[model samples]
Target: MDGQYSHDSRKNILEWSLPVIDEKNKSGSLEFSIDGKPNDFFPVHVSFVSKRNFCDIQVAKVTYIEGGSPVRFSSETSFVVDKYEIL
Candidate 1:
């Protein structure tokens, strides 16, 4: 993966970005560890991009030609998100 890392100890700031995490379109796992105890990192702020959202519905339409033999498809969705935290 391509990444950029920078940190500022005076401001307690860490910037990390991975531009090319996965280009092959396959699910994978990443594991890492911190030196300190887990409780020391309480109230961490994390964010990521997602295509599917629980509050929104998505639909797709397919056609053989310009609006000819049109077929519509809608996803049968359910509640997601295994864990949620507010801090």
Candidate 2:
């Protein structure tokens, strides 16, 4: 999945998350910062692989500097697919 954020100030923190794969494969979240002048945009990407017949849900949170304060936004999505079988 993908996400984008805009900030009005320099040096802002961004964070996002993906549903936990499991105890064995804990591949769930990410964070980073954008450093630049106002009107800066940042793009984020997330990807994962899972066993057949599995489902996953993901979410994203973006925190940025706006008007000298922190503003936050979030979104979530999910998908499911049947296992592939070859004979």
Candidate 3:
């Protein structure tokens, strides 16, 4: 994820780019449809631990850029977690 977002030594931030899933997939495409009906084909679960950040933070704003120039783009951000325990 290096060089994906602007660098700042005095600020704490993270940047991520989700992959584009399609009908030719079996996971990570819950927001898309398969056969007119809401696609509910999640055959797996994913979880992980990282050293990036523990507490969730609110985003200030979003900017879309292309070829070093401002551009138009749409994005959605959410924090989805079923459960997390420290034991």
Better of 1 and 3 by lDDT: 1
Task: Give per-residue CA lDDT, model 2, range 1-87, as digits (tens).
Answer: 323334433554343334445567544323444457544543433343444224444433444556455456565443443443222
Candidate 1 Cα outliers beyond 4 Å, as residue runs: 25-37, 49-87
Model 2 alpha-carbon miss at residue 13, Å: 16
Error of 2 at 40 (Å): 4.8
Q: What TM-score does model 1 achieve against the real structure?
A: 0.33
Output the number of the TM-score-best candidate: 1
Question: Alpha-carbon error at 84 in model 2, in Å?
Answer: 23
Supply every candidate's count of residue pairs whose N, Cα or C atoms clash at under 3 angstroms.
0, 0, 0
Deviation in Å, model 3, residue 58 alpha carbon: 7.0
Q: What TM-score, computed on C-alpha atoms, does each candidate reach?
A: 0.33, 0.21, 0.20
lDDT of each: 0.55, 0.43, 0.38
Clashing pairs in 3: none
Model 1 error, position 8 (Å): 1.9
Structure candidate 2, residue pairs in collision? none
As a whole number from 0 to 100, the lDDT of residue 26 in candidate 2 is 46
